[model samples]
Target: MNKETNYQKALHCYIQASLNILNHFRSSVKEIHHIGSTSIEHMDLPGEVDVLLLVKDEGDLSKLADHVRGVGYDEVEDFSTGYIEEVVLRHRYDGYDVNFIMMHHKSKRKDEILYCRNRLQGSEKYLERFRQLKAAYQNEHINGDEYQVKKSDLFSSVMNMQGDADVV
Candidate 1:
């Protein structure tokens, strides 16, 4: 019998998803980055791939969202924040829940997100610790806005571990 795992996906699946988005967004997208737990080697994930897409500051997000949804990708509207908005898209590809973040090239938050990912990949010890924190959060039954807030907290903790960490 073939069983599907609820959480965790092969790293390459996430990579391909990023590539696909990159291709679709081509000239408009400056770059696409792989992030989240899945981006960290050998780490258990919730089958969700977090990808960051860098676009021009004036990029039309609604159009992009419509385009991605037209192509059969799921849109995650729950990820936007006030002051600085980030468009997040999700899709289940090859059993992986892939998420794409549409961000502007000059956004400070974009740099912070990239920094957090780098920090996570830099230390095996810290990565394992973060895995545990994520595992514990799974049992907390958090949802929507709270989940996003908690995720920010997780990133902050991870960055702080590296000492003198910046925003996350």
Candidate 2:
């Protein structure tokens, strides 16, 4: 009777999927993380699961993409950056937004990714503030693209505030 059951279930499956992706590119990817709304504890979240794939060299990205596609995750063109080439994959697992953010190990952008989440999750006040914003946005009944635009604006600002000098 838990309404959050599906969220938890999907998150569990998504984390497992992230582990599988890490296994697929274990040689290149040293550390893989599950970070995002779903990664936040006690936070109401959607079905999207953002994954961080930290590469050791980031030299052979094509091979990694090929291997990712070979594992049934079709590459979706999203999250392309100047330094980091993000290769998000789409799988038919009940419409889960599984993002594969490929970045160099110990890169600034990589650190930023975790830092953004950690900062919000670190403080209950901030977390509740963000949760309220999310609820307000949802109440507005906006489309997904619009919702993403708003979230992107917020997250981009947060990351920018976290010292935009070195982003992995």
Candidate 3:
């Protein structure tokens, strides 16, 4: 499928997943954000919808994890260096992979997450830079650690420039 087609499919999957999450979590989640490659328009398609689920507090993390598993989401064992204690859950929705990143409402990485998404959504320069990085190291199985660090640095550099190092 073409980029537009892939984006459309990914978006459809995000909407479906978002609705299901809302129906299931309801008041437990403070906010739900559509993030990552699929959320950015004109960016290279990853075909996976990355959802940020901000719960009201740290206590909700375990609850959400249990809820996700009960609802059929498998916990993805991510080896990437994590900036915070966040829960990563994955499930296939309409053939597209939907990743749910559950974190506390006051997590330090919250701004970074929103900033990255907003930057990519609004600025073509940053988006192209990100696209180039992803194009070079999209195949993670071959260069997992390197790819993760570089991707993290890409965001960290952007955050650092704006004096948002607390989250990096």
Candidate 2 residue-wise lDDT, 77-164, digit = tens: 6443333356566665546667776667767777777887877666566677567656666577666566667666667666555434
lDDT of all predictions = 0.70, 0.67, 0.77
Candidate 3 per-residue lDDT, tens place, 1-168, comes to 544566677877888998998998887889888888778768746657888889997888898789889978998777346634788899998988888988898886877788767765666677787777776666554376776787787777655455333432
> What range of 10 consecutive residues in model 1 has the weakest lDDT sum?
3-12
Candidate 2 at residue 131, lDDT? 70
Q: Using TM-score, rank the candidates from best to worst.
A: 3, 1, 2
Q: Which pairs, if any, clash in model 1?
A: none
> Would you estimate the TM-scores of all the predictions?
0.74, 0.74, 0.84
Best by TM-score: 3
Q: After superposition, how far is residue 131 of candidate 2 from its true place, in Å?
A: 2.5
Writing each residue's lDDT as its tens digit, candidate 1 over 56-76 gives: 645556677678889998767
lDDT of 2 at 17: 75
User: Could you tell me the TM-score of candidate 2?
Assistant: 0.74
Model 2: lDDT of residue 4: 54
Q: Is candidate 1 or candidate 2 better by lDDT?
A: 1
